[model samples]
Target: MGEFEFLAKLRERLPPDGPQVKLGSGDDAAVTAPAGATATSVDAIVEGVHFRRGEAELRTVGRKALATALSDLAAMGAEAGEAYVVLGAPADLGEEDFLALLDGMLELAAETGTTIAGGDVTRAPALTLAVTVVGHAAAADAFVTRAGAQPGDLLVLTGEIGAAAAGRLLLEHPALAAELPESTARELRRRQLDPMPRLRTGLALAGSGATAMIDLSDGLAADAGHLARAGGVALQIQADSLPLAAGVAEVAAAAGRDPIELAVAGGEDYELLAALPPDRLVPASDASGEAGEAKLTPIGEVVVGEGVEIRLPRGGQLKAAGFDHFAGPERGSQPEARERRGG
Candidate 1:
């Protein structure tokens, strides 16, 4: 389909616009009003790097593009407002496939109460979608920042981690996943392809006195370091306490890798990790979060020192690392660095 035809289908799936969106899709430019504080975030997905062109389903790709961009809004504890997707697609891409892809994004957009506004559509060597989301806060202090964490604050994580990375590994080498149970494979793939943004949990934490917050886009340990450096506090993550997702351990074992290591280094979980006062330990949605279940849990504590440390249950420290785009490899202290620190 042509650009205009594709956008028309996308607009149909979008949630009905509120007062904030004076104009929806199909305009020279979209207009919006800020009822309160607003958070705007832009994210893009490139072919090969973000998704496999022909191998990955188009709908799944669409959902991921929008889901990833909205995750930033969730991190800020903001409610959905409206969105615009700039498409860099090839001319050879058929209308049906493109529409299907956009429909995927619209489904998630409706789920999050966001409408698709407007954006540019142009030709590119490969398919790419850049999404911009605008979100609004409900009340004062409803927006959380990384700098809000305190030395005494406890670090709480929302939802599961590691499954996405395992899924990625399996996708790269399906032979590895073939050894695992079918259900395990499906769950792991879902983690990578259909990650849900922590919207409700983020809002809940923002209202409940979460000191600092960041979405886990770059794996646990990497993002933990981000929160630590931003808040000027050290984080001590208990390796045993993490809420590892279902199939993560099984998949890790199949790949001859450590489950905890995967949980720490696997990126793209799209979960939220926040520093909270000791009292606000659990969000209402995850109030019944039980052991061996993927739910909110307190995995660490904020400390006065610098850098991050994973307190292994077995008694040794694993210097934490995560994906860094420019750095090639994630920067972290080797085990020897732990001894240097007098561990």
Candidate 2:
């Protein structure tokens, strides 16, 4: 389909007005009404770097393109209002593939009650998708920041980590899948290929005195270190307390790697890490929307230092590491197209 056809399809899929949006797509600009505090975030995904052609389909990439931004909104304890995307591709790309991309993104938007407002399309050398999301907070101060953690606060995590990293590894080296159980391989691959944001859990904690919060886009150790530094306090994490998903250790062993390394340093888990005051450490069964049940668990504590430290067996300590764009490629870094293609 052409640009006009694309717009028409979008209009049919997304109405011009929504429950919280006054105006939407097919206009010079879209308009929307806000509910209290508003939060806006932007995220971009590119072919080869964030995704591999043989490993992930266009639909999966498109879903993740928006999910990344939604994860940011979830980190801030905000409810999504609307989203706009700017998609670009080479002239040679087929219409079917492009439509699949839109279908994938729209499915995520619908699941989260977020409306697609408007966006621009153009030609480019490679596939590129950027999503700008607008969200609203429950209250001005209800939104949590990385800087709000206080000493003595408990560090809580939603769900397990390292599954995505393992997934990426399998994608990069598909041969390894032969050694892993089919169920294990599928789970690992799914986490890397399609991930979800922690929206409900975040919203549930907004007014429950959650002090600091961050989404685990990178690895837990690295992102947790960031949160600790932002709060100007040391986050002493208990290594044994980390919530690693089942089969991670086996996957890591089969891949000839350490489970702890991936669990702490593997990126793109999209889990939420929060710092809560002592009294706010309610049972997971009691959290709003069943948000805490079975998924929320305490893994560490904030102390009076300036960085992060992990408590290990026999009083041992380990430094946490995460992905850093400026630090260049490390473990879990995606290969450049030329490198992957053996150029």
Candidate 3:
């Protein structure tokens, strides 16, 4: 049976009066008590697909797995509350390692003020983690979607991009990685292993007249396309204006890769990409007290077109193309793989 079918069977086995189950499992659907402006999101992590087995610590893996889902909540301008986690682990995982994974998840939950209210565990051939987070927004309309950008809007991004991608390349090529400074390598490693959601930035933009916005989980090129399509407008990204994290150029040069390509096509930064009205592009410091540390940089403009186009600093406009899941046999390319990694 498929995973969904299996989950349905498990839900059927639950007793009717199972603890505070205002919403039980099974049937065509189930209902939960109406929450205040409820916001929900789900994410899944697989062993070979998301991370290499034995390459990451149990705690770090667990923390990253949960943080992935929370990133979505933050993008929606939601305040995280509780989460449900489901695990599928191979028989080879030791009992202590399994416990450590749970402990790691709990650590992140405590830090984020979220609770692990419920979940399930099962045996599988590979290790997998899936999470569903439920949060609430004070007002439903306060949430941001990708469909409101307009012509003349200024594109702004929070934090720097490409660090996680650089870190991944380092993990695969230790010799080249050695060329990077110790501090740069450490920071890149942290970004890859544990990403912070742009919760405050997203919310701040939502309140600051952002026309459209999306979380930069996928590569900037790919996610920009999503926003453009949703908004029925064209997004023009300036290649020269991209904000690159410190040491990104050194790391990319060592790997013989293009730093701009890494910034455009690498995924999982978990920063916010927003389009704000031109006149309203006030510095982030003017909006929030902590903005000085995470400066917002304007890198593009929304235009009257149907899709995304990147204007290179040196030459012509290039179509914005990154990763797609159903691109068939043409899916193994570097950009495509990076895009698929986001989902």
Candidate 4:
């Protein structure tokens, strides 16, 4: 049977009602009535698709897998509580490696104040890690969404973009990664392996005049497009102003790739992008300050137009297009095309 079918059959065998399962199975993740407002998110990480087998450490892989699901919770302005894990591993993997993976996940969960309440394990041809996290918000309405953006809103991004993609490129080409200083390389690698969800920022911005918001899982251009399409407004990203971590330019130069393209189209940054009213821009900084790093940067503005576009400082506009997971393997694997700056 297919994955969904297998899961459905397993879920059907559960008892009709239980204290721990206020709402269970079939949804994104099971829910239990916590003390506060509730939210849930799930993420699945595959071996070949999400990570290379030998290239990544077991603990790091587990932490990253859990972090991916937690990002969804951050987007919903939720504070993490409990996590349930389901893992599928190949028969050939050693017991030590399996335990290391769990240890890694547990370490991160503890650090983030999330508990590992329960889990399931099974054997498969390839390794897959799936985590479902439950969290509580202070209020039910304290969640941001892509539907709230309006014309004339300012667009903002948190943290630097393209570091993860750059790190991936370095991992695939060690010679290029070695060209940079050890610290820079380490930071980029860390960004790729351990993405920090903007949980505090999302919580602060929710109901505080955020017009619309989304996490940058899929490149900025792609995620911005999602927000634009959902809100029925055009977004114009300022290419020149995108923040990049140190050594990004050097790495981009060595790889013969446009740093702007990487910044715009590279995925997995996990930073939050928000649309805010002009007056609310002040509070954006306030929200970011609570995070201590001041990760927010105003990158663009929402305006009247047909589709999303990127404005380069030089003299033109670049079309808004990035990775689309559902568009099939061919579309996702290809490098994004670079178009002239303006329509």
* Candidate with best TM-score: 2
User: Which number leads on lDDT?
Assistant: 2
Pairs that collide, model 3? none
Misplaced by over 4 Å in model 1 are 8-15, 282-294, 329-343
- Superposed Cα RMSD, model 2: 3.4
Task: List model 4 lDDT by residue over 1-343, tens digit each.
Answer: 3445444544443334333456655666566766657787888888876677776789888888888888778777677777788989787777667767777777777667776655676778889888988878767766676887888999888778878877767777778876789999888877877777777777776646787888877778888888999898898888887898777777788888788777677678888888889998877788777756446789889998657788888889865356554565445433632211100
User: Which stretches in model 2 have alpha-carbon errors above 4 Å?
Assistant: 283-285, 292-294, 329-343
In candidate 4, which residue ranges exceed 4 Å CA deviation? 1-31, 326-343
**Which prediction has more favorable TM-score, 2 or 4?**
2
For all candidates in order, the CA lDDT equals: 0.78, 0.78, 0.74, 0.74
lDDT of 3 by residue, 1-343 (tens): 3445545544443334222235544433344554557788999888877787666788888898888998888767667766788889787876666766777777787777666666777888889999998877677887777898889999988889988777777676667667777888878867877787766666667677777888887778888989999999999888888888877788889878788777677777887888889877874435633533266889889999887777888898644345555565555456534433444
Could you give candidate 1's per-residue lDDT for residues 1-343 as a string of tens digits? 7767777776666666767888766678887877768888998888866777665689888888999998888788888778888889987788877877878888888777877887778889988999999889866467898888888889888877888888887787788876788988888887787778877667777777788889887778888989999988899999999888888887788878788887787788988888888877754334424222236788899999898999888898876567655442234432211211000
Candidate 4 accuracy as TM-score = 0.85
What TM-score fits each model? 0.90, 0.92, 0.85, 0.85
In terms of lDDT, model 2 sits at: 0.78
Locate the minimum summed-lDDT window of 10 residues in model 1: 334-343
Candidate 2 per-residue lDDT over residues 1-343, each given as its tens digit: 6878777876776644557777678789988877788888998877765776657778887788889999999989998878999988777778778887888898888888888888988888888889999888756776778899999999988888878878877777777777777898899888877888888888877667788999987678778888988988998888889888766787688778777776777778888899998888884326744764237778889999887887886787765466654454454333321122110
